[model samples]
Target chain A: MSERLTPHAPLTPAVLAILLSLAEDEKHGYAIMKDAVKPEFGGITLGPGTLYGTIDRLLRDRMIEETGTTDNERRRYYRLTSQGLKTVSAEIARLNAAVAQGRALGLIQPKGAR
Target chain B: MSERLTPHAPLTPAVLAILLSLAEDEKHGYAIMKDAVKPEFGGITLGPGTLYGTIDRLLRDRMIEETGTTDNERRRYYRLTSQGLKTVSAEIARLNAAVAQGRALGLIQPKGAR
Candidate 1:
């Protein structure tokens, strides 16, 4: 278990989505939002309040940090810190466990059976 | 996509855990809480406020329904509706996609490598 995840209780859906968006590359708030709306993230649409608030909290927690700033505030780029990566990894592990449990209990269909 | 999941946006962590707990068998609040503390649910501890509040909402949404009651109010058993099952299955599928994305990005270790 990642230390960050345990203390944080559970990451909000928006927080996890933002962290995953930054896993591969630095992205600004809008880019994170766009990525979150992709199928992998359950097509979630984050309102401005949620997007920026989660980003602010993540920044404060040192899970992510600003990588660059632009004249346009919306272009400020951010990336996951090592801590963020670890936390996200732990969360993915947790989600995988849930998936496994669901499978065992016959809640989820086997692969290719959908 | 499950209609319930979409309109509800994202299910709260408590809601998802409660739904999963009720998936296999009818359980009262205490039983659900016990199941939640098990490793598979990430050892979450839901307070009474969150537990019963979420249960009320799930009942309102028709995701779960009371099955039986004991002398003690805490022993009111609940089970997932077909709709609840579908919603939970959909949520598990979404989480699976996130896990797969994490793996593709090398955020999660491959099985047995942890």
Candidate 2:
């Protein structure tokens, strides 16, 4: 696993969904999906197995840590570790720059955007 | 499918594997996995079907184009368009910034890197 990630092990969309959710604070399994599957993911939606699979990977990678227990239940809450936050921010920066480049070439238009 | 990617249809690892490969030059199926996997992807290599699946998506997105055909064996060569190069560059920049941020906090180390 260590060798697998040494050069680059990124957050899969499933993982990204979890990290983006935790970036706000913390949440258990199902709650993450509710938040993550907005108009953004276009309802492709993460299933139970997929969500947990990503969670397990992130936990193993130390990109996120178990923060606390939930009130209504004992569902474990995962929060982005310093490393995870850094990874997410970095990915966002890369995405932003790509968008900027597209704009420069008129390849992508802002269009009717919010 | 378009809506699914409208806000953020990023390069999945499968997709990234393909893009990174094409960034250097151009190639077809088996070759992309050979180059992309190296010691990098940790042998989670792209399958024959997976490679083409991503290639199709990239074609739809205009990130790659079907260049001239192969010589010895005709495997459709895929090349990164200008837009593709920009995306790859942006992604690399994002990754570099994240690495820099990690270094700033002493959270990640350079170690004995090659």
Candidate 3:
């Protein structure tokens, strides 16, 4: 990612939401789950096992790291890495440019229209 | 997603690469596959059925439309929609901002650093 040396990795929204939440500040596992799932998924929630499962994968991929910060005694905190941001940035840039180009062509329109 | 009153839909990069390739100009199914898969996924090319499966879904969602722009007798061209751009824009924004924020926090660093 970028000019920095980083390993290749891909993460979906569910995993991304967790990283973004921690980007502001390191947070415990439960807090991350709360922030990520709030309003976006409504009543739906990622089980503790699923949340940690993704976290472990992110950790293994070097997307996130464990931090001392936490709000729960029973939970650990996590945060993003430099490579993580770079990867995220590249992914976003790839997407943003595409979207921008599409808008330039006036492709984004009402379903009935197109 | 960006308050455009567009419908909610999530498409994978495989699907997105297809749209981005078509963003510049319309191309038929096989052409889209060639443009998207080239140098990206390497030898792993998406089958016609898979390409159309996503295309049909995107078509139904209005992320793409048959542009009457085509280069193959057995295929058809496609282009993006305004709603698609908005959706793509929002998704990229979501990712970029997160990446930016993580960098700001210095969370993005080497694996051993954190």
What would you estimate as the lDDT of candidate 3?
A: 0.60
Model 1's lDDT to the true fold?
0.82
Q: TM-score-based ranking, best first?
A: 1, 3, 2
Q: Which candidate comes out best when scored by DockQ?
A: 1
Please provide, for model 1 over A1-114, each residue's C-alpha lDDT reduced to its tens digit, 9 standing for 90 to 100. 555444455667887899889997888888898899986765678989999998999999899999876658659899899889888888887787877888888877776685
Q: Compose the digit string of candidate 1's lDDT tens values, residues B12-111.
A: 6788899888987888988899888876765678989989999999999899998866667657989998889888877877877888888888876887
lDDT of 3 by residue, A9-111 (tens): 3345566566667666677778778876553322125678878898898799888888776556787877778766666555444443444444454545422
Model 2's CAPRI class?
A: incorrect
Q: How far off is residue A8 in model 2, in Å?
A: 4.6
Where is the poorest 10-residue window by lDDT in model 2 chain B? Answer: B1-10
Best by lDDT: 1
| Model 2 residue pairs with clashes | none
| Fraction of the reference Cα-Cα interface contacts (below 8 Å) that each candidate reproduces | 0.65, 0.06, 0.07
> Which one wins by TM-score: 2 or 3?
3
CA shift of B69, model 2, Å = 7.4
Predicted model with the maximum TM-score: 1
> Per-prediction DockQ, in order?
0.66, 0.11, 0.12
